[model samples]
Target: MGIPKWMTGKILCKTGADLVNATDPELVKFIGEIYYGLFRGGKIRQCGLGGRRSKFTIFPHMVKKLNTGLHVMIIIFLCVAIFFSLVSFGFCILNAIKVPYRAINGPAGACLWNFLAGGFVVLAVTSFMAAVKLHQLTERIANFRENIFRFVILEERFEDCFWICVASATAHAVNLLLIAISGIHFPKIKTKTEEVNVTAEDIMY
Candidate 1:
């Protein structure tokens, strides 16, 4: 004997179509009704002629939908990222001015290089961490929205936010390496001995 086919409308799954097909008819019908209408007491759908698939839910229009509060929140995060980046860049510039000194067991140009490098390393590491965290936070927020602009672009548009972080962090790290290189200097003795000049006479041939 052949199995009977269901005559109801095509089942759509919040999870996926397979799960929808697997659900019991009564529960399926109930969920379908809830998703399709029961909550709002409406049953209206329209077929598109071509291209864009736009499904409009009517209940939302009944009330004034004034605030896209989430968009502002994402903008705030972007500002923070920009702020940190600027601050990091400032430190890079700050390190560009070298105070060359030569004293064993004391300050040297290399010490300044190392100090600047440490700052770069710290910023780069923190940038990586911030990018990762921001991407994740955006991911969770993206799922709740229907539009991309309403959530952080780090998540809403990108399927996986971790890659976004990786790219941003890589660039920042490269920039830091360049900055570290820029801050390096040849050793110079800032301690004054009124120019001690050594000639061939000082060295025995």
Candidate 2:
């Protein structure tokens, strides 16, 4: 059968349409230049775009909408994790005390995990609470600044508390990661085989 001219024309037209939207390497290079320009000239900010902002805002909102049972389980897990972390920190301190006496022997990974993770959890939580308190104190002072006769207003205290909280939280997150990695080896059980010269005779006896 002879090929139709109309069909061939339609195929060529579709190929041309696809080429219109094809990516250009030259255009990509131009985009790279624009990005560098924005950075060097300070013409653009690193703020979240619409899609990025939506993703960033979605997780907490989704968590807030979780069912009561799931919420309760989350709370329970959080409480237990916090409690165990504190205990681990205590164990770390005990291990530290015994370190100088050379009384403790074995793989220090577990002790390290307990100490670091627990201590970080405690430090982060305490520092965050302290930051909250400092913020409240700052607000109270600001509200009563005119009414009070001799008030020493320290706004810097809140900043310091916030930084401390940030550092502690970062440390706590690292500790959690370390603990998770170390936990893989924590519950290991080793089996040993014993050899005897007269194993059959001993079994008969």
Candidate 3:
């Protein structure tokens, strides 16, 4: 450790032996650095209690452990929400079908099936959106590595896709229940050419 002549002091030891004999804190630190540079291949010195402790150790102030109970509660809530929403949606379709049919007087035909088909189509679209999000969440949970070819774009797309899935699932499920209870009728196309095929082949009354 060559100390500049202008900065000469007790801390700047002329030799290794002199550094070993020094008692000042700064001098000891300087001496430690010199030996560290020589023996540790130009790295910082390991000395006293300081050497034993890691520089990267986290303070208690920033630590945040995940709450297991909260996670479980959230999953349970999702299950219930999905269940009730689907049930209500089904009930709405039943009511809509039953509206036009008066026992044996009015035959359940295209009108009933059409409404059911529309409901399913809307639900299917929503499910597709949810599936997209679920796929994104799955990827994130499974893969964390970023590739050189797709470092920026893939990650960004993954985040967007994941959030969209969550939002769409929640929105569609809630919307389904709302539409079911609101006593609303969604109009369907009624084509005269699309007649009901009621062939009495098996029934023997």
lDDT of 2 by residue, 1-205 (tens): 0111100000011222233443543222111100100001111111111111001111233233323243344334335545655665665566556663432322254445445554544554453344325433222222221242222222222234234435654765676576567547566688987975878778899
Models 1 onward score TM values of 0.28, 0.26, 0.25
The weakest ten consecutive residues by lDDT in model 2 span: 1-10
Off by over 4 Å in 3: 1-65, 100-165, 173-205
lDDT of each residue in 35-150, candidate 3, tens digit only = 11100112122332232211210112111222223323433444454554555455556666676455222223323333343344345434433432543322221112213111
Which residue pairs clash within candidate 2?
A: none
Better of 1 and 3 by TM-score: 1
Superposition TM-score, candidate 1 onto the true structure: 0.28
Off by over 4 Å in 1: 1-48, 52-70, 100-166, 170-205
lDDT value for model 1: 0.35
Candidate 1: clashing residue pairs, number? 0
Candidates by lDDT, descending order? 1, 2, 3
lDDT score, candidate 2, position 196: 52
